[model samples]
Target: MAQNVTRAGKSRTDFRDAIQPFLAPSLREKCATVLAGSVPGLEEIRIRCGRPLMAIGGNGDFFITPQGTISQSPAQAYLPDREDLDRSLQLLGQGSAYALEEQLRSGYITLPGGHRVGLCGKTLVESGRVMRLINISGLNYRLARAIKGLADPITRYIVVGGKPAHTLIVSPPRAGKTTLLRDLVRQFSVGIAELGFPGVKVGLVDERSEVAACYGGVPQMDVGFRTDVLDSCPKAEGILMLIRSMSPQVIATDELGGRKDIEAVEELISAGASLFTTAHGSDPEDLRGRPGLAALMEWKVFERYIFLGRSLGIGTVEKLTDRNLGSLINDKFVLRPRPGSGD
Candidate 1:
């Protein structure tokens, strides 16, 4: 138990170190102080000019006081000023915003450790599209975490005959779909020894830079040796491109929506490559309600469907089903939290 606690502490320290260089002095100190406690489930740190400094954890959202203590009332919280935001942006961009113009145009920047900072403010629009963001007023620092063995229990359902099956993970926001997808990619790419599944080439289309979290064209997370990541590329284009170029046996992507993405999935299937992806929904019915997914469901494109929820815990696997929506598992499976996993 003590060793587990120590491991958790080290994990928190690593998380702090990853973001410290990008924070202003004052904000950094406050964050460090709060992190020194037992906030193991810490997920996001939100900083907004003229608004309360807040930290979101698994329990709920709470404001951080100037003394680095949690507060329920925003009236007693610390408010980040213009200087704080400016200094943070400067540090995040390495003192030059122009160098990160493309990332800013996408409204977020992926940090060195795969942590993401989401930006919000005025937008520069041209030809019916947003060119860039200016006068940034808010920033959401989302911590990146890789839970190494999170996919172990579900590997049997996803891998068949030493190859990946067509699977779609369904979950609401913050239900660990992305984390599960990341681990599945790693396991499939690196081979699961226990299951006697040999590694296969995996093409990861990380559109939001969340799954693989590439930094400077390299994956910051441990995706796997045989995985090839197309960082920050659109899902549709990336899928087809990988089919033509990488010759991957399996293609994994996050959040399947939009007609173009569906069209790309069809192309991937037609090319005989396995597909592993995620979508935002509560259950099979929720997926059927969505137009794009409904079409895919009618075609029986996905062979396995995994549903995740927070009834028991954040990463609980509420149910597993076959292509016809028949129950595959009789009991709910809860993912055990690894020390310092922050899942």
Candidate 2:
């Protein structure tokens, strides 16, 4: 998984700069120094009220000390008070809470660089609905790293007969399904002329801003030149909209299932668009047990199923099967170096 270890086109400063705006002056300076000296695997930066500032990476979680060094022991960590959290939220919102109310209600805010800040706060309820997130207590900064060639291993199976396959990627959260899905879109959109694959139109439904990581109607990540993205749109609605309007040859989305999503998938497939989507599951049985998924399997909605796990770090290929449950790739032969497995 050396590919996963390196950021490819991105720099360490890019990740640090993305999250810098959300930090208080003192903490930002401290973290900037730590980030400058840190390795490339920093995946997340965590901030909490009255708690120590922490950063997590492929190596493991480490606290950012006051002296701007990575410390295994929390004793040397930089602790921020409640006032810092307030200031951080102010910086995050940019003095316009009303403008970000919708994202706040969703418990996350997408920064310009596609970095997502997950909010933990008291829920303000109104008529059985969460109207707002108030009294923000903690924030989790999930850095977005787009690796260009992450889909190289699976491209052979997905691109069959000179067209994108109806593929369904399965993985638990943070297992890199979204990253893989994004790269697949990029590969399909850009195409490999030398490999005999021509670039095709790809319609992307980025419901949670995870795939395209769009900011202000523009994609922060490279989703390929021919990809059309509908950002922050519901999966079901966006799929139908893309099929009807964009007339995409390949329709891609992330984390799909349920009656509406399944129904929409059927409609898109029937409209002659190949489907590429991901779901949360560890194995085929998990996919079978998931409500509404059995119907999809019965219909053979997905022609290729790619299962991902963390055994070999993010985007590890655990299994690849066809519609009939026949193995397409030998799972044992797909091994990559797992995390913490020394080079």
List CA RMSD, all candidates: 2.7, 3.7
RMSD of 2: 3.7
With candidate 1 superimposed using the best TM-score fit, by how many Å does residue 128's alpha carbon deviate from the native? 1.8
Per residue, candidate 2 scores C-alpha lDDT tens digits across 191-278 of 8654689989999999999998998989988898999999999999999999989999998998888689988988998898998899
**Model 2 lowest lDDT segment of ten:** 334-343
In candidate 2, position 197 carries an lDDT of 93
- lDDT per model, in order? 0.87, 0.82
TM-score of decoy 1: 0.94
lDDT of 2: 0.82
lDDT of 1 by residue, 70-131 (tens): 88899989999999998999999998988989988999999987889999989999999999
How close to the true structure is residue 124 of candidate 2, measured as C-alpha lDDT?
93
Error of 2 at 320 (Å): 1.3
User: Over 4 Å off in model 1, which ranges?
Assistant: 1-10, 337-343
